[model samples]
Target: MAQALAAAGARVLVVEPNAPHRLPGLLGAAAPPPEGQGQVAPGIWGLFLDPEIAMAAYLRSQVRVRAIAERMVRSKIYQRFVAAAPGLKELIVLGKVMMVYRGRHQVAGVGGFDQVILDAPATGHGVQLLRVPRLTLDTFGESPLTREARRVQEMLQAESTFVDVVTLAEEMPVNEALELEKTTRDLLDFQVGSLIVNGLCPPIGEAAAAWDPGELRADPRIAGAHYAATWCDARRRMQQQHLRRARAATRAPLECLPFVFSADEREVVAHLAAQLRATGASRREAC
Candidate 1:
């Protein structure tokens, strides 16, 4: 999605929070500065946010004493405080993200990234991350943290904010996706732009999908081939069932990405991006 948006002329920023960052490896681009943005593609930039680095930066921005920012972040007491706080780490990380988002808005088409795509953690951690702003606002009185949280919350709940929920056509992933969609609507009140069902098998005809390799299993020569076909057909059937379930479960647009058979990660991304573009999914957002 980041590359696709960049292709459409939007300057994109991908936030890599998880380390040994996967974005750098997937894009086959050099890792960006730990605290700064670097070009990943023509218009795409990457920002890998080390938690400690983000925390130190956040502290520096908040504290009047610039000299003590680094010292404070490195202190054991600060670490203990962070541990004690429920969503402090997530909030600090989001603080940097909102800084980028705000910076983009400030300079709309002039410079900097136009879109910020956060490569946040899986559903559980992601929910926690998204919940930090509300949590902060609820837990504290008026303070710098609360002020920052307000901005983050505003950005998150903004109509332009699109939470693209990616899932596989399987029970567990579908369940997680449904849970996320429900939470986003009912609890967080965020817009779920799309429900992306990924890695779907190519459609087989009705006869083929229902075909059985009953007699072919006895033949040695074509047994493996038939078995493979049968397995793929079974998978397609299962995928269809889950797809129906997912469609029935959410009103959000459900998009599907076919399973690509390739060792090249770039090929996979390019293929998926093309699929997304073909489906007219060109809307820009802080995904």
Candidate 2:
């Protein structure tokens, strides 16, 4: 999706908050030159959001005191404090995200980004992350950080910000997605923009069913092929059943992404992006 948006001429920055899923190491291995931000593909850039780096960068941007910010970041006191704080780290991570979303960065220049996609934490952690700012405001009253937290909270609740939930067409995940949607709406009052049902199997059940298995079973060469088709058809039917249940559960715009048979991550992203564009979910203009 980020790739497609970038391809469409949007200034795309993919933010990976989860340390493990960060692309820098993978991209560096593929193409040398280690950096905070690297071009993962044509027009698409990826940034690994190390909390300390983000906090330092954020401080430098706000205070215009790079040396002080750098020193503060390296200080054991600051590190321990940040580590001990319940949601301070998450808040800083999101602050960096808001900065990017607003197109404000000390090193990257002061132009706005057309699109900023966050590979946010899983549903439960994500909800807590979103709630931190509000919680901070309630607890801390009106400090600088709390003020910034309020701003982040406002941005989150703003009409421009849209949250899209991606889930597999399975009972557990679908139920979880629905719970997440309801919980987000109840707590944050943020309605999900869309429910993306991923890895949907193609409708091959009818075609497989129509084939005369008896004729193919007699031929040893095609027997395996027939069995594989039948298995695939069963999977497809199961997927369709889950799809129906997902649709019935929510009134939000639902989009189904077909399972892409590709080993390459780029190919999968490109395929999903195309599907998003086709569904009119890829809005070119930045909010």
Candidate 3:
């Protein structure tokens, strides 16, 4: 999605807040700079942030105590503190995200990014990570922490900021997507943008949908072909069922990306990018 947005002439920054960053390798870029952005392409950049690094950076700027900040980050007690605190880690990571989002962080010669796409963890953590600001406000009451939380909460609920839930057209992922969508809307009050359904099996024509590989199973010459076709047809049918369920359940618009069969990551991204670009164009026309 980042590549697609960048290709469409938007300055895009993809932030991987999760550990063991994979976005950089996926985008064919070298490891991101420890504190700033790394260029993925002409219009696309990537940033890898974690709680400790972000907290140290924050303390340096805000407290003007660089030594203490570094020492605290390196300490076992500080690590446990972040782990024990409910929303501290999430808040620190999100603060870095906001900095990039608001263009406080810059890429020299190119200025700040037009869009900051966070590659937040998807296994329920993404939803919880987003809910941190609201949770902080509820627990802390009126304080400096709550004040900062309020600011982040307002930005999250703003019309300009949207959370796009990406999932596959499978039972488990679709279920998670639906739950995540509702939580973001009802609890977080954030606009649920498109429910991007990835890895969709392309539609089989009516004839193929009704194909009976049973007849070809008896023929030795094409038995393998028959088996392959049968499996693909079955997979496609399953995808359709989930797709229907997703469309029926979701309030967000569904954007489907075809399953790209390729070993090269660039080719896969390019294929999806073309589809996404077209989807964006159609949406603009409709609006």
What candidate 3 gets wrong by more than 4 Å, as runs, is 33-36, 74-77, 107-110, 141-144, 204-221, 281-287
- lDDT for each residue of candidate 1 in 14-87, tens digit (9 for 90 to 100): 88775777776676676654345566667777777677677767777778886687688788999898888778
* Ten contiguous residues minimizing lDDT sum, candidate 1: 104-113
- Global Cα RMSD, each model: 3.7, 3.9, 2.9
Pitting candidate 2 against candidate 3, the one with the higher TM-score is 3
**Model 2 worst lDDT run, 10 consecutive residues:** 24-33
Deviation in angstroms for 47 in model 3? Answer: 1.2
In the range 1-287, model 2's lDDT, one tens digit per residue, is 67567667776777787566545443333642244665666556766667766666666776667788778778898788777767887788888777666666521342366767778788999888878898788777678899889778887887878777889988899999888887777778775777888898776556766588776688876787777777878888888788889888875678778898788766676787777666664432210
- Each prediction's whole-model lDDT (CA): 0.78, 0.73, 0.75
Q: What TM-score, computed on C-alpha atoms, does each candidate reach?
A: 0.88, 0.85, 0.88
> Model 1, 276: alpha-carbon shift in Å?
0.7
lDDT of 3 by residue, 109-225 (tens): 445677778787874788888989978877776876677677777778777788888899899999999999999888778998778889977654345546666776688756766
Give the lDDT of residue 88 in candidate 2: 83
Q: Report the Cα lDDT for candidate 3.
A: 0.75
Sorted by TM-score (best first), the order is: 1, 3, 2
Candidate 1: which pairs clash? none
Report the number of backbone clashes for model 2.
0
RMSD of 3: 2.9
